[model samples]
Target: MNLRIFGWSYAVTAASLVVALLYGGWEALILCAVLGILEVSLSFDNAVVNATVLERMSEFWQKIFLTIGILIAVFGMRLVFPLLIVGITADLNPVEAVTLALERRPEDDPTSYAYLLNEAYPQIAAFGGMFLLMLFLDWVFTEREHTWLSWVERPLARIGQLNRISVVIAIVALVLLATFLADEPTVVLIAGSLGLITYLAVNGLGDFFEQAGQKQLEAFEEEDAAGPRNGSGPSQLAKATGKAGFFLFLYLEVLDAAFSFDGVIGAFAITTDPIIIALGLGLIGAMFVRSLTVFLVRKGTLADYVYLEHGAHWAIGALAAILLVGIGYHVNEVVTGLVGVAFILSALASSILRNRRLAAQGVETRKTADELAADHTSV
Candidate 1:
């Protein structure tokens, strides 16, 4: 793992910490630091999943993801998103919302920006929860070559063979949530439905383009085997490009937005100051995910650690459940972080075991990863 990719992230983290200390006091700095740590625990799974999608993208789009994606994560989701939400929920215009966000601190007043954002938490939770749920459910249903927790995963995959199974389960979950858990059931229904629709549209198109990209690669590989054409080869055609790359990029952004919902809302629990939230949750968190994504792609972490993706998707499923449940009840950030980390660490441990098992069995395909997994042990 080259540390070079994180150069920009470190620069941003240091710059933000300096800004936090200068802008507020030690209190703000402390809160900012805490949020940064929390965001890593909260979003580490996000980096894993992002790497899975990102590896399918072309180099050009991958560059765009690291550059433009960070800007959107910081400025768009972390900053403007809160302001925009406050504006819509509070019935304040854009300027008024910005003024209120900047001027007012977190007070006991019902009119404060934080108060308004908290009030609208359910809608945000509903939308983001359903979107992430769809992502998790889609993976859950798909029959895969590899799996973790095979006892549970194997059963789910068997049942998932039913057509439209994931969608059915998701809709049923929505109906139950709206019926039993919501204060305003209609709002939950609409928001949740929109989330489901967005997932279908985005994920569906991304898969379509991915298949197309695969076909293109196959064709290029065939041409290369026969004779070289232009300067293209398997390496050049390896990634998804054109429309395929575009949709993959879009899917990643939406996925990041969904992941940030809980973090954004939870940050208010730490500090009502938008600037601190932006600096901590937005800047630092974005840096971690971005750098991790690049690292995973470069190092082939997913291939080496077979169960990491499974662990990440499981964490995502758990998070989706937490968000939906949070609609009516308080969900602790500690619980959320612990759940994600547990899955990730457990999956990592399982991957090591599986690598050893395969190595002991003398599986030819497992040669490379097994070597990386346990270098001391002879094959």
Candidate 2:
């Protein structure tokens, strides 16, 4: 781990802390630093998922994700999205929502932005939880030659052989939670249905475009094998331009938004200062997560740690369950963060052990081959 890979991000974080101190004094600065660290801890799995998608993209698109995509993650999701939620949920205009957010600090009053947001928590949890559950289910159901947790994943995959099993499980889980576990069944039902719909729409759109891109690439490959047909065919150019990457990028952004939903709401529990939340979480989003994605891609960490993605999706599944359960009962964010970290670290340890076994087996095979060669020479 070359710490210098994150030198720029650390510099930016330091600069942001200085600004926080200037704006809100020592207490504000301390809170902001804590929130920043919290964001990084909560979203480590997010970096793993982002790296998986990003490794397939071209260099230009990768740069676009780091530069333009960071803006969307920081400002779009962290700042404006919450306002949009408040505006819609509270029936206030955007400015009114902004006022509501800024008017009540955590210390000032109970009926502040935090309170209103908590009021909207049932629906928020439903939407985010269901969406994440679908992602996890989809991954588990898909057939793979390689698996990390074979005992758990293999059984799930076997059951998942049924057509549309992921959708079925999501709907069933939503219904059970809404009917039996949720405080507001109607809200959970509506929000969860919409969440499922949104996942289908977004995921289906990405798949459709990706299939088209794949076909285009196949056609271009055929044309290339036969020698260039024309100057540069449109299909050839389309494949080169990474239409699939564009759709995957869109999917990744939506996924990131879903992941951030809990973090945004949870931040209020720490501090209800909208300014502090924005500055702290925004810096983490901009500096840390983005850099981690790029760093993982460059270093090929996923290839080395084979089980990392599996662990991430498992952690995501756990988070989704916790969020849904929290609709009726409160679950601490610290618990959620700890669970995610445990899965990731456990997978890392397993991967290291497996690599050692494979290395020893390889050495043994080479030794046997060398002995066989020696025996043949003597004969």
**286-337 in candidate 1: lDDT tens per residue?**
8988998899888887887888888999999999999999888879988999
- Model 2 lDDT tens row, 122-208: 888899899899989888887565578998888987887899989988999999999987777998899999988988887776666
For candidate 2, the 10 contiguous residues with the lowest summed lDDT are 370-379
Query: What is the Cα-based lDDT of residue 349 in candidate 1?
Result: 93
Model 2 regions lying over 4 Å from their true place: 1-4, 107-110, 232-236, 239-242, 363-379
**What lDDT would candidate 2 get against the real structure?**
0.79
lDDT of 2 at 132: 90
lDDT of each: 0.85, 0.79
Q: Which stretches in model 1 have alpha-carbon errors above 4 Å?
A: 216-240, 364-379
TM-score of model number 2: 0.91
Each candidate's clash count: 0, 0
